[model samples]
Target: MLDAPSSSPRLALVSEDPLARGALARALSDQAEAWTVVAAGTQEELEAARGEPPDVVLWDTGLRLEEGAAPDLGAPVLALVADEAAGELALGAGARGLLFRDVAPGMLGAALHAVARGLTVFEPGLSHVRAAPRSTAPSGAPGPDTLTPREREVLGLLAEGLSNKAIADRLAISEHTAKFHVNAVLAKLGVQRRTEAVVRAARMGLVTL
Candidate 1:
């Protein structure tokens, strides 16, 4: 289960551009007295925030998710992107919603509240991108895409920077089993490397970042 939010939700903001980061922080101050904003202008701060997990992570174009990481944060994150493609990347990283820089300040609070509830929030007139094509194939089709839920769970953990031993401990499995699942994920994606598997899976929308 996800962690419960404190009396007031904690907010974390990450932006490569300090001006943009500060602007967002100031705009969010009107949200709630319980809300606290933690500012991060680099990947280092982003990682640090993830360790303690903020209630919300407002991401601008500056942040990128590295390999061996699936977004498994305790707090929800809303991504700010410059365009549609950037939004897709944020979605792959488990962002709860995508917004452009021009969004009205009033919407930020509502968006944050919506995302905290696990729904995707966006501007009313923005276009929605479809990720997958409809398929008529049976449930057990003959291909690597038919991974079981357990396999998907393992794959997600692998993408989240967990070593084999670490994943084993988290899942209560043997290291060998965790390693086996990682290999399976690689083979399913038809990639020989962990990095490639993550990229391929995320692009295909088979696995979230």
Candidate 2:
């Protein structure tokens, strides 16, 4: 569940670029009233967030997702990405929101508000780049390329960042059924993780955000 927006909502900005970090801080500060914007250039600084975690963490996509990493702050993460592919990867890696670095003031403010409400946001008109064709059997059967209509529906919801419970509720199916469908989708996509499945489905044009 999302936290309620208090009188003063804290926002955390994480970026390595000095100019970009400073500019983003100022922009967010002016984005809304009583917004406590905190800027951090390093992971250590972000880890040391005072009181409860910030309402949201806006990070630059240039910072690679380190292996075995966990969420540093207990807030929804909004990533600054360069393009569609990067945005998809950020989503796959569990960033709740995506915005281009050259975003306008209105869009930045809107993205922050949307992400704070526990909604996933991606840059408009972003689509996946075509991936290499998957190897098929000698008989030319569709190997992992064919998903049932129901599985396709589940895939789309997964791309939207819905949990099993939410997907079940949205699809009018039991939670166990939702889990089964999700596992089936992952297996058919030849991926081990939910994010990888979403990325592969996007590459295949099976779903869009």
Candidate 3:
């Protein structure tokens, strides 16, 4: 009952364990009819599914990326990790949202809905996402650099490794308009390259990865 439209808001369900994958799939399948899922047991399957351009992916953080793979789906990626540390690792690795593996089945839908709308999700108490990093700031570093709340939303998609084109699609802006925000981000971070900016912005607590 799923159509593979190149522009549809399809979802890719990714997990290594059959039971976990099946369970997550069942949880997502319960959402409204527009949400489609492509089950992927491996990163290879994940990347292949991305060619169809799903709007969001429900990923288990344990899936390994092939060397030189972008290391994540270019679309919104919601990671189901084992703990807050695992969530941090996934975020640092370019995931856009994190949920505990034991997230309430209802929460699973809410989190996916949020991620698809280009919003971040954090489990409670585990919700350290809004706070700028607390680790001691590196000498001469600007930890806790704050962005206008608007820029924060832009940066959230940037952390996902999306080209301005992809980000514009998610945020409903023209590519030229998105490029303007990106240039603004580059100037603010004093960095080149999307990955470098994300690493540094997150490291310095300027932005939550």
Highest TM-score against the true fold, candidate: 1
Task: Please report how far candidate 1 places residue 200 from its true position, in Å.
Answer: 19
Per-candidate TM-scores read: 0.53, 0.52, 0.51
Query: Which of the two candidates, 2 or 3, achieves a greater lDDT against the reference?
Result: 2
Whole-model Cα lDDT of every candidate shown, in order: 0.64, 0.69, 0.65
Colliding pairs, model 2: none
Better of 1 and 3 by TM-score: 1
Residue-by-residue lDDT tens digits, candidate 2, 1-209: 34546556667777657777888877766755556775466444566544467888888755443211223688888888777666666665567877787888777777777787788777675534322232222343224447766777889899999999999899886564577678778867778999998887777778886
lDDT of 3 by residue, 98-121 (tens): 778878877777777778778888
Ranking by lDDT: 2, 3, 1
CA displacement after TM-score superposition, residue 152 of candidate 2 (Å): 33
Q: Give the per-residue lDDT of model 1 (tens digit) for 1-209.
A: 33545567666776667888888877877554446764456544566456677667777664332222223446777877666666665666467787787677777777876787777786654348422222222443224455655567777776787787998799876554576667667666567987787677677776687
Error at 160, model 3, angstroms: 34
Please report the candidate that would top lDDT against the real structure: 2
Clashing pairs in 1: 68-159, 68-161, 69-159, 70-159, 70-209, 71-209
Model 3 spans > 4 angstroms off = 1-8, 31-34, 48-50, 62-71, 129-209
Candidate 1 stretches with Cα past 4 Å from truth are: 1-6, 30-34, 48-50, 62-73, 131-209
